[model samples]
Target: MNTHTRKLIKLNAREGLGVSIILVILFVFLSVSSEYFLTVENITNLLMHSVFVMLVAFGVMFVLSTGGIDLSVGSVLGLCGGVTGWLMMNGTNMWLAILAGLLLGTLIGAFNGMIITRLRISPFLATFAMLYIARGLLLLFTINEPIRNFATPEFAFLAQGYWLGIPMPVWIALAVFLICYFLFNSTSFGRFVVAVGSNQEAAHLSGISTNSIKIRVYALSGLLAASAGILLSSRLTAVQPLMGTSYELDAIAAAVIGGTSMFGGKGSVTGVAIGAIILALISNGLDLLAVNQFYRLIITGLIIIIAVGVERYTSTRAKTA
Candidate 1:
């Protein structure tokens, strides 16, 4: 590879390496601190538990790559889950309900994309507005009550059951990562997203349709967020309106921690996955160590700051080189 290509690869690897190193450190710490931490069951539980966050992170990375943020993902997730629950409880077909939920999420994403691109509003503001709007709709539709799942036993399998000794949610997350990996690395549209993120005027001058790409990116983010909601609802057998509150922050943190650029034009699906795992490991290990929840938040914040700072340093060095 040429020097420029090698530098790009190195930059990508650098973003991901922190999470890998942290995971190993956390694993060793947990293994020493708690007998249950390294057990097969605990490890399975940890991976299973991180499924939702990981799924959200994968999609968010794409949005970030286009220099956009979607604060509405968690709210959209809650709204989708609530709709799915409401439909199933009223004797709707499970398959149709799931599809409808996903569609709803896509529409929500499209709306955000439209408002941002057409109206020239900042994506941050547009998605932030949708966050409140979605949350309000979720609560109103559910009458402020959790919607319990009354669907067939088969429906529960999607979220809680395992295939080949692996939880379905984790498999779903893996599928999400794989799809995003291809979408970001192998698709022309993905190329446009990066191009626009790097320079909107330049991309437009080059005949790329930046607006359409932004809309698609946000829509995909919504679809993934809906998937997360659906799986969580299935696992809990209920859709709680407040279920995904603050989850957007967690997903964004995971993406940022994984080495995705907040300023856009940079990131990877794999990096986001590693970041999600690191976040999960931190929470899991801390719980094992009986650390305070408040302290966990503080530590998470510190780690994000350090990660971003390191990324900034490396990015600057890469530019200088």
Candidate 2:
């Protein structure tokens, strides 16, 4: 209806296309370079590995959409998984242990929110502090050991089982993506998130409770991260206190690659899902090519930097337009 609206739409489309093209090119290269890449088993493994990162990416996308960041997600995931495994090992009911883990994760998120919003701490600083606190508590609980319990068949099924030839973890990931997609695209709260990210003062003047939204965004991020932990532990039937080290970076990279703006107010669940797949593909491809593990880390870091640079350029162009 207007030139400005058309330009905004075109810009968003361009951002989405950029990530999609990268994913496609990478996929094609992997498929062509590795004969095993297209195998059913390898594809299944790729989806399974990507599921956890995708879950965390969804949480990151939400926080980024609200112009906030939470660096504690990876630590919270480890802590939740460790706690749940510890509970199960000590003979707690599987369902109860899972619930407890989720609760603790949500509480940690709320804590981060409180400090950042109420205490006027920067989100980066607040969540950075939480990262250490959560990891420390996890180590204290587990004594720096992994929890292994053989009694929880039901819990194990959450990650390892299949329904109609699809892994349970994939189903779980799909369910999460659907729920988040709906929340981000069809809800008043989602609109509020975008508004707040775009301009806090304007959103506040429009009667939005910016603080409350930020708190909830962080809490949701924690909840999702906890869920990822649960699935990861279930898949391994064990949990280590430091299992999720550096996972936050992967999640952030996925969100950024998926067209979630670092400056906020823009994101897409579909894009994030594709981004997760791309990361998983890169890892799998590298492994197939017999690349060094250390090199993989370097490549991942480079991708993150590149994605952020692209986001910055796009944001600047949009503003100028």
Candidate 3:
């Protein structure tokens, strides 16, 4: 109805279109690359594999929307899973152990956010510091050893069980998507996030409480990171301190590829979901085709570069026109 509303809507439409085009291109490329790429089984496998990255990407989307980054997510996730697995092994209640893991993740997130907002440090530096801190804590908790979850059937089921032939992780991912859709589209906080990203000084001047928003985004990111860790731990039946090493890069890559601007203030969880799926499908299809693993990494890097270029071009064109 208003000019501002109209602009936001248009921006969202362009992002959605970009995601659709990306999905189509990926579909065509993978389908042509390997005969097994479009099979029903492979598609499901791809979805399952992508769920972890998708979960992380969704949360990363929120963080990036607020013009921040969480490089510590990967390590925080690994540490949470290792801590939970160790607790379960020591005879803790299953639910309590999971809660503990989530709490640990939240605390780590708060620490990162506080350090950034309170100390006026850049998010990159703050989260980068926590990345190593989390990894070291994880190792200390497990005594530099892998923690097993053999005695925790319930916990394992969180990652391993399926209903009606669909993996629980897939369901969890879907639920996360729906929740994020609402959080971003229907809530006051979501609008604040956009405002803060668009112009932090204006937001602060308007009494928008930018610091609190930053803290919330970081904490949410941590929660998602922990969820990914829990599901991964369940499936693997073991938690290693190094489990999520470099995964933050994948999450960042997915968000960037999904039309989320690294400069901030523009992106959709839905688009990021599609981006995560695209990455997952590429890896899965490549494995099925027996392509070199190293080549896959190369292709991934190219995709990120192209996506960032596209975002920049679109933004510049919009600005000039």
Each candidate structure's TM-score, on Cα atoms with residue i matched to residue i, is 0.94, 0.92, 0.93
Q: For candidate 3, lDDT tens digit of each residue in 1-321?
A: 699898877765665565567678878988888898888778878899999889888889989988999899999889988878888888989899889989988888888889999999999999999999999988788785568844466777787888788888999999999999999989999889988998999999999999999998899999999989888888899887689999899999899878787767876888889889878877786797798888988877777677667755665665554
Q: What is the Cα-based TM-score of model 3?
A: 0.93
Task: Give stretches of model 2 more than 4 Å off.
Answer: 1-12, 144-146, 307-321
In model 3, which regions exceed 4 Å deviation? 2-10, 311-321
Which tens-of-lDDT digit does each residue in 1-321 have in candidate 1? 698798888766665666566667778978998998988889989998888998888878889999999999999999998898889998999999999999999999998999999999999999999999999999898885568846569889999889999898888888878888898889998889888888889999999988999999999999999999999889989777798998899999999877788888888788788788878887888888889888998987887787667656765665675
Q: Given candidate 3, what's the lDDT at residue 274?
A: 86
| Global CA lDDT computed for model 3 | 0.85
lDDT of 1 at 171: 85
Full-model lDDT for every candidate: 0.86, 0.87, 0.85
The pairs that clash in candidate 3 are none
Specify the poorest-scoring 10-residue window by lDDT in model 1.
310-319
Predicted candidate 2 versus true structure: per-residue lDDT over 108-220, tens digit per residue: 99889889899999999999999999999888987755688644768888999999888999999999999998999899988999999999999999999999999999999
How displaced is residue 95 in candidate 2, in Å? 1.6
RMSD, one per candidate, in order: 1.8, 2.3, 2.1
